[model samples]
Target: MSTFAKAGFKSANYNSFRPHYPPSFYKILTEYIGKEAGKTGDKVGKTIDLGCGTGVATYPLLQFSQNVVGLDLSPPMIETANSLKAAKLKELGIQDESRIEFGVCAVEDFDAPPNSYDLITAAECIHWFKDYPKFFEAAAKHLKPNGVLAYWFYVDPVVVNFEGPHNEKLLAIETMRRAQQIYLLYVYEDPKGLGVHWDRPGRDILRNLLREVDAQIPQDLFKDVKTQKYVPSVDGLLQLTPQDLRLVREKITLKDFTNYISTYSLFHNYSESTGAGAEFLEKMIQEFETELGWDREKTLLDLNWTSGYTFMRKSGE
Candidate 1:
């Protein structure tokens, strides 16, 4: 992992080119908001995108409201996000410029006025927050009555519908899991912060955070859809280059694949782990290569995923 001073793929090309959250994902949020607006007879007010990495979630916020503010701890990430536009915007020749304002400040320190916002959306970055209670408190205070606080994410390389081989799916899922783990901790610079803990490590932390958030969850608003499949195996995940989208491809395990598991920073983080971790990853990669038997170029790799979401809204009060 890069030092605390270094940023991860959060500011890298992957973020620039990777898939944005599915339209349906935003559709779901908008539907929820519309329902709220209908009952309250008022549209959702201004929104804030906390940790809006490249504003991937910001574009979707347009579906519910036009006024949105995106906050992030990394200036570079925010810069990248602020300049990025929804892919569909270009495709449809429709440009909604200035719907989001990108700022470099941790939400913990961002002192916006209370009850100022109608919706707050924190995508993949919420888990990295150090103080969930403070964040929610501030978010709740900023949100007006019936305001919605939403954090969600999506994966790329949409790999669920493939039927190539079991190993392909296994490797893709494991690779995605490990890479996404970067946010839990060690994702940011060492001193800067770590992830909430991707699965286990992060899960324990999320479990505790959820306990506090449970009370604030709007009965119809809180939705933790953990099943968003947004992370794909990087073309270079195992040091394997990305493959062109070809339906019905071949496969292979680690033995037949690259010897450079060094390409994986997840393993690099464990260099001090008595060499056991390295050996284990090597074995796992090799086993995957062997089982797949589809090593066409032995250099090209495909990533798959089973995507879902975790969401929460304030219960109707």
Candidate 2:
């Protein structure tokens, strides 16, 4: 993720790409924040989102607070977020229009007016912070007395059931897997030659951080979080004739796989950075064109499992 930003492609990709958090998730947040409001007598409090690219989390927080601030280092992202049309805002349930605000600033550089905020959220943005301990301490400073901090993230689910042999279904699963593998290779190769792209924390890290910071919550974010099984809807995408996927281990070529990899981010980035990324893809396509030598059009994808988890709290009265 940091590599993407370092490459000057953060906002470029963020504005057009990225998935929207489901409204169901926000409704749950509203309930939790409302609970805090009842105890503190703060009807609608100030909420801040750190590293809020395009305000994905900020726009959703509007239901829980009258004033929400989205701060990100990307100015272009801030601009794009502010100009979203009324229909777009309507989709986010942001009718008040003035409830949301976005700005260009790094979270570390921010100095909070003591106890001025009721809630703060860092959605998919915490990993980019340099000193996380200091960052959380700053978060603690901003809380309006016992204020809540929430973290939320998600990943695309992995598919396991598609693992048998070479049927149409198996072929589809294989295709997705191969694409993912190439993607991993592309990123791991240091496309932009940036420093390490920090790995995202899991439940264990979250627990350790909360403990180190002495932060407590009523609910365990991961207690109920479980990996939802992946059932491949492979029948939908492939337009190949019955003959293509019918035989056991029927051959396919590199060109076939490149088509799918092109749908991925790393492919695009690699194409831009390596200059030969497209040529490399073309080479793969040509290599796989022949079905005679050994096996062909072989695909295996890395099915990733992603989950969403959250825990919230209310500020002191």
Candidate 3:
């Protein structure tokens, strides 16, 4: 997360390339919160989104809550998010631009009155948070009884299928295998790759789909806990989660896919260290094209990330 705070980091590129959560997932979340709200005869009121980089996931919360606050440690990210406030409100046809706000603050340091918020969410950012017990304790303290706590993430996407000259599903499986190999070679396995540049425990926690964080959720502090994962497969078989919870599934050009790779914090660190960032990414794109027999510009890849989410409510006293 410190990498995102550097002066040289490109918040705009991070905004442009990163995958936003699907409305469908929000539907699932809001429905859960809605059911809880019914118990108290209260409408969804306020939300605070932690580590809300560039306001991607933060903006969408406006649809469910009357007020939303997005917080991040990176000044640049908060600046970028604040700059887009009016525009996002306009896009949402929201009359009160003040309904949304962005601030520069670490998630752990963010303080609010007890029982102040109806919902608290962390999107693709909670893994970077230290001290899960303290964090969850803070969340439970700040949330109204029965208020919701949710966090979700999307990990490396795999080429599940493609539209190309070779249309066979078997070819798709092979392409996925080769793509995984390329990812490992460039992102992890190679000495010259970005492996050494990654921030630890955070990266490891994310790559494992937040299983560690989920385990430490402190069942006593929260109730009605639910967690789900959508795993991508190289073998030819149907793999699906609930349709509404399918957070990241898209068809994008290989070039666009590589652009997404450029937004990685580890890639930025590697580029700074080696000064061959662009060249290295191009090589990765080329290797994918050459090994998979797909053109970077023309092939449309059906990409599915290994994504998961956990939703729970603050336990009653």
Stronger candidate by lDDT (1 vs 2)? 2
Report the lDDT tens digits of candidate 2 across residue range 62-134: 6557688888776666776677636557885556767677787887789868888887888755545666557
| Separate clash counts for every candidate | 54, 13, 0
- Residue lDDT tens for model 1, 3-52: 11134323544363444565555656666566432232344658888777
Worst 10-residue lDDT window for candidate 3 reads 34-43
Ranking by lDDT: 3, 2, 1
TM-score result, candidate 1? 0.58
What TM-score do all the candidates reach, one by one?
0.58, 0.60, 0.93
Badly placed stretches (over 4 Å) of model 2 are 1-13, 34-43, 85-87, 92-95, 156-183, 186-272, 276-305, 310-317
Instruction: Please report, in order, the local distance difference test score of every candidate based on alpha carbons.
Output: 0.49, 0.51, 0.84
**Candidate 1 local distance difference test against the native:** 0.49
Candidate 3 lDDT tens digits, 127-225: 999999999999999999999999999988777777764424445667678778888788888988888999998999999989999999888889999
